[model samples]
Target: MSQGRTTEGVRDQRAELAEANHVLVDQGILDGFGHVSVRSAEDPDTFLLARNLAPGLVQPEDVQVFTLQGETDDPRKPYLERYIHSEIYRARPDVRAVVHSHSPAVIPFGVSTVPLRPILHMAGFLAPRVPVFEARDTLGSGSDLLVGTAASGAALAEVLGDAAVVLMRGHGFTSVATSIPEVVYRAVYTGVNARVQAEALRLGECTYLSDEEAAATVATNTPQIGRAWQYWRDRTA
Candidate 1:
């Protein structure tokens, strides 16, 4: 767990985070509003996320550090839903990275009764169930549905539990992993899985991977995530 928090190490992490922003944009997993963040290697109590800017355009200088309590002194305004990252990190010590996106293909499943399932081997993480967080249930009906406060964010994190991903009803979804690349991989594939599942439902009955099959596939696929990360990283480059 040594972060090598030398000046070079910090710079390298910033660059990787910036690259992740662009990579998510290239994969269409994030638009102008979504964001990605990584727990600070130098300070586990803090994390790195870009200031309020489009993911594709985030630069190293734009990346700002913030405490896990969601406090930051950066001159630029942070994303309103930054609590999504903060509270999740607070709740899950194993999670090192998080990606919150309004990915178009995945939105329908969040707002509808259709559950997003692992229709393909690449998305075995969706096997059990993608928990849906209904904001109204926690924040009241008139609320904005954004994880804008620490309390609301904590509620969402609770719903996420040990799951790798959680769907926010009428909003989007959040994906968490042990590394930035892995989280990006999960976020992108989750969107892909959603699209494929939607299409399968259109034709007729769709067969999903059973829990055992999904668990096996997930075990096998976990280590190969770097391949997709490299592909997406190169695309952004």
Candidate 2:
């Protein structure tokens, strides 16, 4: 793609991602915290992400182009403690998009010794394993040290493995996929799974899906994530 076209593609993805980000914020996924990032269509060395804007109010221009490996060239533009996004993109070539958020329920498993297993059909994606990156010592929310250091961020990426998401201990989550919609899809499921798991713990022993069963279940989730995207377009259009 030409530079302009590539930039346009990133911008387009940014708009779509931002729109989905708006959905997350509206549904209470993010506040001023959290961010959505997509690998730049033009160059892998670059990626697109929201700057200091609220996910609910993101605009095209508000999406910033950033180098995936280092500090941004411009000082005026405040880059997100962006390692969570960049490091994962660098480590997982299969992932084209990522969403990091500070959702409330998801935090329980992130900090607690308890695991956030797949207690619902929507969370079958996490059947194999979900790592609570027990790498942090202290901090508040996703603003933890993972975002501050590239090495820690890479450690965060390693925890994800082939899984769709990873919980940064004492922090939040970093969800990845081949597209913005996929990440958003997983994001919704991530929260839904947490809600179900929390409720299940209270009720009784919740049945968990095995690897094969979970993989098979993923194939059957036809309109799950796609519906999440459309749900936004329909409501926001």
lDDT of 2 by residue, 1-237 (tens): 587886677668777867877877876667877888888767787778877777777876777777767456555555556887888888888888898888888999987777988877777888788877776433344443556677767777787877888987667888888877778778878888998888888887778888787887888884466876788656755
* Model 1 C-alpha lDDT per residue in residues 1-237, reported as the tens digit of each score: 344546777898899999999999999999788999999888899999999999989999999999988889998999998999999999999999999999889999998888899999999998798899999989998998989999999999999999999999989999999999999989999999999999999999999999999999989999998898898899879
lDDT of each: 0.93, 0.77
- TM per candidate: 0.96, 0.89
Highest TM-score model number: 1
Residue-level lDDT for 203 in candidate 2 = 89
What local lDDT score does residue 132 receive in model 1, on the 0 to 100 scale? 98
Off by over 4 Å in 2: 2-4, 137-146, 222-224
Worst 10 residues of 2 by lDDT: 136-145
What residue pairs are clashing in model 2?
A: none
